[model samples]
Target: MALNLNDLGIFVQAVEHGSFAAAGRRLGMPKSTISKRVAELEAMLGARLIHRTSRSFSLTDVGRDFFEHARASIIEAENAETIVRTRLGEPSGTVRLTTSVPTAQFTLAPLLDRLAARYPKLLLSLHVTDRFVDIVQEGFDIAIRSHQQPLPDSALVQRRMAAHDFYIVAAPSYLDRYGRPEKPADLAGHNAIVANAAETSWRLLAADGTLQRALVNPVMAADEPFVLLRAASSGIGITVLPTSVCATAVIDGTLERVLPEWTAGQITTTILMPHRRGQLPAVRAVVDFLLEHADAQSGVLNSLANA
Candidate 1:
């Protein structure tokens, strides 16, 4: 006997509500209808799924196993429906997204504020983290990453959003004390404030499109970008970072761009999804918004890049 989705749905609901009557109430169906569907489901499976007494109900061993699979199937079905509804209907829903802490605070968060004001029905959940997150397993609808490489293959559909350049920046006080380097090799003597030990190496592009790499040991090292920025703002040392990361500080004259000639390799921002077909309405909206936001800020970014 083939299992009916309706029957399995009823059985799952009955287990969730802990009683046929409660399930009926939740599903807006009669108690008899709920009970009958659950019975039909058990008959189709040739197993007793529920043990019912006067005032309560409990799942049998077989039911417990069935329930797990049933629940997952139901959720996938619901997610499929949501995806269809989002594509066909008004773009209104909550999109759960994540990004690195510094980028979220300085870049994406402000963009989200604009999006929220424009689309009142859209709910945005932003999770800021430095550690890697499994977007699909963690139930995130979208994730924004800023790096040259694409997301690792598993279930994710990665889209290249925008590309921006990085820069070597330092405070005016620091420049006054140590002086700015005219070339990449001059950075060897500088006390660089590095965000990560892994980031101790910097990549630059030569005039002929060649890659120039440099390794500079920092006198001050920090795990957090914001912490390193603060240290840099205090005239600590020169740091190589994305232009957007130091945009506000550079604009406000707290930090100044150093090594205007040596160019850092372009960094690309990417939008990640579990699958194209599984995208929710809010997720699509946010992704679109980010692209537009990047375009709008391109002039300022271009200046920073060329600086």
Candidate 2:
């Protein structure tokens, strides 16, 4: 029996939307028509795909398995279309990207806007969170992350974008109330706003290649870097933060660097791609745009360091 792709698509849509009526509303078709098409699809497959009721609907075991394959098929079909369009010099597809919230706010938001302006046909879906996301499992095409340690071995391809320098900073009021730390060990006496309460210790690299670890007494702790920056800016305590996040405040004198002779540590910013083979044109375009911008930013940083 030949199965209709339209019927299969309707069935998948019904499953995704959780009801025939919802899928009909989304697809702008009559609910009865949607229901009939799904029934026809199930008949062609010779299996009961969904368990239907007057009030609700659910998928059977076979339906659940079929849904997974059907979803993959739809994605492959869309990708194939996109590939063909790309070959004709028109790149149009959705690119799902994930990154840290701070990076999303401070760095990526404008770049994405520029990308949208450049590629009017491209669609971008961005996921911003603090937790580590599994790009492959989550079906994300790209991910940008900052890591202090080397990334774990994985099949994903990684490209180093830039190195993020960290600084220990405090509001001038806090530094006035509590004398600024002259050295890394002096940090133990001052209040600290840290990312992790359990791991309040920070390793600092000195100017002369010396390493110092300081265990701080946490006055405030939060997982997000922006929260730490807020607390430190509010005169709550000294906190370590990425220079990119605190540069404006530092330049404006709202925050002063503590122990300017040392750094908290450097985290490498990297962009990860799932695979090189069969990459979507949209994905390749975004990757190249980001790399170009990152290189430009790195050159500015180099010039500043030299000056």
Candidate 3:
């Protein structure tokens, strides 16, 4: 029997959800039915699509490539359907988005909520992490990232959402109690709640626009940005953080932006996805919403970039 589109879809889901049972649940089919479809498809192709154990399933290398190709076709079919539906003016579907914890919590989360409210049928699956995740392998529709430069992957396309403003900050209590420094060199005497150890050796642009470098030895350190921020707020030490992380606190006067006249390079926030034609309908909708909202927030980061 010829392999059917439905079976191909089942195969895609099995790879995406990582198990026959999960794929069966998503497709509203019995586990046996899902397994039978996949097995049939693999038999028709004369290649094993998955390496399966009693409890787990993983794509074979051929299966990975096949999935990429199959997903593109699936996206095209979905988009064709959407084009017809959207012409009649109704937008709906599930979009899986990923971002760092801070970006999702402080920046994208509220905007997503607003988007979801406007489009009642649209389901947004949000995955938050501080580590860089592979969107295709992870089955994510899109990702939000912050970096000093563009991602070098040719397989991925990136859209600049906004530039991020990084600030050197310390609690008022700590600065007042320990004596505020008038210059970067003076930070050597003070304690720092370090986020990145290399960040301790900070290089800043001076008032006269001269480059100034400082080698600081932090008394406290944390791998997580939030932990560093919390330590700084508790008067443990000072920290260098992005405005997205510190903006609310700065506005609330809980944490103060220190060395305002001096700052390091700006970090640009970006939206990333696999480079492909006929992208999924749901992903496109989320991307449109993000771009619109990003333009609204552009000025916030541009100021820091130009400064």
Query: Highest TM-score, which number?
Result: 3
Among all windows of 10 consecutive residues in model 1, the one with the lowest summed lDDT is 274-283
Instruction: Give a tens-digit lDDT track for model 1, residues 1-307.
Output: 6778777777777776667886786567998999888887777778898889786678889889999999778767867777787677656767778899877876786676688787788888788888897665455778888876655666578877777666788999999998887878788778888767666667777656777787676888886667878999998888866766777788789988777766676678888886632454567677888878888777787776555
Q: Name the lDDT value of residue 151 in candidate 1.
A: 54
- Of the two candidates 2 and 3, the one with more favorable lDDT, higher being better, is 2
TM-score of 2: 0.68
In order, how many clashes per candidate?
0, 0, 0
Candidate no. 1 TM-score: 0.69
Residues 1-307, candidate 2, lDDT per residue (tens digit)? 7777777778877876678887786577999999899888887888999999997698999999999988777767767877678778756667889999888876687587778888888888898888988765455789999888999888888888888678899999999998978878899999989897787789998878999889898877898877888899999999998866776677678888888878888878889987732266788888888889888766764553333
Q: Give all TM-scores, in the order shown.
A: 0.69, 0.68, 0.77
Which runs in model 3 stand beyond 4 Å of their true positions?
1-3, 11-35, 39-73, 196-200, 207-209, 276-278, 301-307
lDDT of residue 262 for candidate 3:
79
Best by lDDT: 2
Candidates in order have lDDT scores of 0.77, 0.81, 0.77
Report the Cα lDDT for candidate 3.
Answer: 0.77
- Which window of 10 residues has the lowest lDDT sum in candidate 3? 274-283
203 in model 3: Cα distance from truth in Å?
2.4
Native-vs-model 2 lDDT?
Answer: 0.81
